[model samples]
Target: MRIRAAEEPQPGVKWIDEGGARMKFLEVDDNTIDVNCDTWASCEDELHARHLFIRWAQFACCWSQGMMASKMIN
Candidate 1:
């Protein structure tokens, strides 16, 4: 799967391939985008795959919490 890097990606933005498979990021940051690449590759429970997923989840959750805090502060 090829992912185009972005500076600030909108929510629900996805990439649909010819096979009709879509992958969207939950959130994006300055450096990377947090996307659900579960089915992007046929990884049958590999350690690296799991680590990537965990990192994405962590990034998403951290962004969400930061946004919430900013909203509360403002």
Candidate 2:
């Protein structure tokens, strides 16, 4: 899959697109990130967003292990 690089960091993203999908994230009290990536395009409003502790690993996306992004970032 091809990924468009961002000029700056962005939030919650996980994707592979043999078909299309979307994921969204929400933060809680500056402490956590809640994310959902539904393969089936379920109701956006009813995704029932929640929160959890955040991590750098969790936010990393658009590339798989050993790809250039991983190499450059590491």
Candidate 3:
């Protein structure tokens, strides 16, 4: 599985793809993000969406911490 910043069509986007499942993220504000997902192999799109949001939140937390540490060191 791989996750990366998305380009084009929208700004402040993130995406993840893991074979059968795919997810997208859109930053609504500094503290909020909207997550969308489609799990073609499963019937629980809602559950997948929640999972994607959690993963993105984890990534965002780590990313923000890294940026803060970088700023402090510089």
Per-model C-alpha RMSD: 13.0, 14.3, 12.3
**Candidate 1: deviation at residue 29, Å?**
23
TM-score, candidate 2, is 0.30
Expressed as tens digits, the lDDT of each residue in 1-74 for candidate 1 is: 34657436756444333222355676567655565533344433476557656756786688679967986896
Stretches off by above 4 angstroms in model 3 are 1-44
Error of 3 at 40 (Å): 15
Q: Model 1: runs farther than 4 Å from truth? A: 1-45
- Model 3, 1-74: lDDT tens digits are 43354334554443444445566888899866676755443324677667766775786678668857986897
Instruction: Encode model 2's per-residue lDDT on 1-74: one tens digit a residue.
Output: 33647434545553322434466777766655566664432222333222111222343443234445655785
Q: lDDT of each structure?
A: 0.56, 0.42, 0.61
Of candidates 3 and 2, the better by lDDT: 3
* The best candidate in terms of TM-score: 3
TM-score of each prediction: 0.41, 0.30, 0.43
Of the candidates numbered 1 and 2, which has the greater lDDT value? 1
Lowest lDDT 10-residue stretch of candidate 1:
12-21
Give the poorly placed runs of model 2, Cα more than 4 Å off: 2-18, 41-74
